[model samples]
Target: MVNAPSGISGEASLEDRIARKARELGFVACGIASAAEDPVRAERLEQWLGEGHHGSMEWMETRLAHRRSPQGLWAAARSVIALGMSYAPAHDPFALEEVGDHARISVYAQGKDYHDVVKKRLKALARWLVAEQPGAQVKVFVDTAPVMEKPLGEAAGIGWQGKHTNLVSREHGSWLFLGAIYTTLDLAPAEPHRDSCGSCRACLDVCPTDAFPAPYRLDARRCISYLTIEHKGPVPEDLRAGLGNRIYGCDDCLAVCPWNKFASRAAAMQDFLPRPELVAPRLAELLALDDAGFRALFSGSPIKRIGRDRFVRNCLYAAGNSGDAALVGPCEALADDPDPVVADAARWALERLTSAP
Candidate 1:
């Protein structure tokens, strides 16, 4: 193994210490990027934002300068340590879609929220860096921050962003959760990874909603993942049928990638293992969840963020498409739900059920 350069102390060279601690903390890959201007990246971000591709995620527009370039976040920051943790599932994620009566929650949201899991590890690494450097200042972030993690990961040599706009690692495929630690310590940077998605349009073609307007560009309004999970109000009628049983985020784009053949199931990270109930929950069962029931079911999972009303709204859409008259009772029950969004979706599902051939 290539060791850190001579004379570097405080456990070891920053890179060696970080790599060791990260491995102990369950990270699959770690890399460093020296803080510098990212003009081309800034331009691309500005263009994407100008095009309003972020949909209702208005926060993406608030910290334009800080998000596009790390130097803007912290003036003295010398390096950004990017980390990736694998959440690869043991079974094919797409297989769950065939179960007609069940809702297909995304694999990543099957267990404890990754933002919490990855953030804890990132903070641990940050703590180690502070202890080692004594005077070093560090700020750690998971997806909770305005940081452009994919681009930073690319600059740090973790992986290149695939056409689907997710970071794709050679070893972990597209099943990695990213986190970062910005520090005042100067660390040698790794060579950036090149995009290996050559000629593969599988991700784009597989989207049921045609979310991708072009390669490497996504229209969040048309994205099933965004429609089901991110959009708080009623889901658009046109996209509901295409959403099928996916009541949370959609994974068709990632599932179709050929690179996934090389992916390995993540080692037992308790936070990533699926709850038996969430694996293939019945649409009627999920639609029956009131506020308390929804809270109880998704207590530790990322799906909890959508809350009971939004979640039931999504389930209602799936119930409509399920074409199972059994689900019609649950859909009608929710038609008068207190939440307008839930009520509207239930009414729509009830209508679809009634009109079915």
Candidate 2:
């Protein structure tokens, strides 16, 4: 076990020691940043929400002050220890796009839930940091918290928020899962990473749904990941066909980033490895999953969060776009589902499939 240094002097040494410990605990990258509110980012967020970019996820509007500023989340926090774990895929995540009638789950959701995987490590690191500084209060956050992790990560030198509105690390590409440990300790901050995404509109151009209205800004309503995952009820009529075979979170933007050339195929953590069953799930099979079967298949994965109804709704959209006769029977069966939203999506999908040339 790597031990924290005794009587560590100066901020730089302590920062180094902490970063080393984070690496020892399996984090691919680690850094620290002052725990102050970022007015610039706050303004951007306010404008984005005002424009209804958040869509049905009204939670983004709640505790607006806290979501914009780390200080609002925890007044006592003097520094934020940002950490990242790589879930880089071996092959291009977009490679499976052409596989007709197969469901394309996001690269990140192909295995275990990242919140479960990242939070455990964050807690472990927070405990170590608390022990090292005695009396220093610490709180760890994953995606569940109101904390703005991406900006904090950029401030901590982990990466820059790319045009796609997600953190882009040169070393880890667009595949890093972020976590934070807010602490009262005044740890030395790392040099902030400058935006390296200049002139690269690959992420924006690649979005199937034109989710990015501008660089570094996303209108989540049109995002396939949002439509397929966060969205409840039937998807908008015009966008269902654009969903194609994506039945979970969409990775088109992330996968197209040029920085991903540096990403490794194998994830450092075993839990992030893709499950063979989820890699290219048959639309017919996925549409037929009942609550029990859905739970069993996605036992430890993030996909289970949306439940059977939403998942099947997404699958139906894919089936509608597939133009394959094999999936028509399943779509017809689900058109009469008990869940009104699923039934609606089924009918829409069936109509599209049956109408296809």
Candidate 3:
């Protein structure tokens, strides 16, 4: 049973009211979990980090204390509110795989940076919650925080962590953007979402680089998304071919999950709708972008955070895999790029493109 907010009770229960408000604010799912520490979640994170699966994201290890639990980050936190906003795509993310001349940005990154969108919604929810129960202190966190959002998401019954190490909703599938609100107000924890990925190897099988060492395990070093976005300098030689035409993030694992069959495009918040230019961007155009051009093109995009150099380097990798000789002229221009990484990627792409049988 949900604890109704103080001096506020009529018909709808507290959980129902919050759920309705979250839905009204564009979140598709909302659930509450106790802010108490979970040894299992903490241990798993320690194990994952110990295994070096985080790649070059050194911040994960640096902020290990706060990441262990909601309370670890904020001492007075008594309840955790988890929310999910749908970003489910209307089209298949893998459709561009055979269309090499075009770049394949991940479905999630094609829209405005989700960090801004989700955080705004989270703050709104927190504001409403505070107003409902005066003096109930709150702090909100999206992906930027060291919080264990997925585990909190699971604990709050938002979704279960799937084999791909991403939270999967039966309703939204792998297409939800998650955020959390830690409040000093105590609320009953929702029943945890049970694992439902049973007997399905689709997410693992679809990985182009075999990034998953086993079910429910990911080696980020071998992950195309990590290599393209997080890793600096040149990509490992063996993994470049696996990148294919994917210039930004990869969606292979998320796209193949059968649970997404239930995902609805209509459920997605308007903020997540793909921009026309990002949908089927050509490699030739992206490969030709200079710093100013890159900044202007991706002004409000998540891609902008990776900066012009990293993004161009990714485009070069895609160009190398494109088999489109027309991109050669653009790649040649970047061969002496100011950034060493971009220049290296250009040379690598040139070799692969010219030497291709």
Could you say which candidate leads in lDDT?
3
lDDT digits (tens) for residues 88-130 of candidate 3: 9998898899998999999999999999999999999999988
Residue 290 Cα positional deviation in candidate 3, in Å, after optimal superposition: 0.8
CA lDDT for candidate 2: 0.86
lDDT string for model 2 (1-357, tens) is 112234545444677778888888889889888898777888988999999999988889987878987788899989998999999986567776887678899999988899999999999988887788889999999999898889888889999999999999988889999999999998778788899998989999988888888898899899999998899878999888788889898898889888988877664688888898988788888888999999999998988899999999988888888888888899899888999999998888778778878
Segments of candidate 1 deviating more than 4 angstroms: 1-12, 266-268
Off by over 4 Å in 2: 1-12
The TM-score of candidate 3 is: 0.97
Output the better candidate (2/3) by TM-score. 3
Task: Judge candidate 1 against the unseen true structure and give its global Cα lDDT, from 0 to 1.
Answer: 0.85
How accurate locally, in lDDT, is each candidate? 0.85, 0.86, 0.91
> Which candidate wins on TM-score?
3
Error of 1 at 312 (Å): 0.3
For lDDT, candidate 1 versus 3, the one ahead is 3
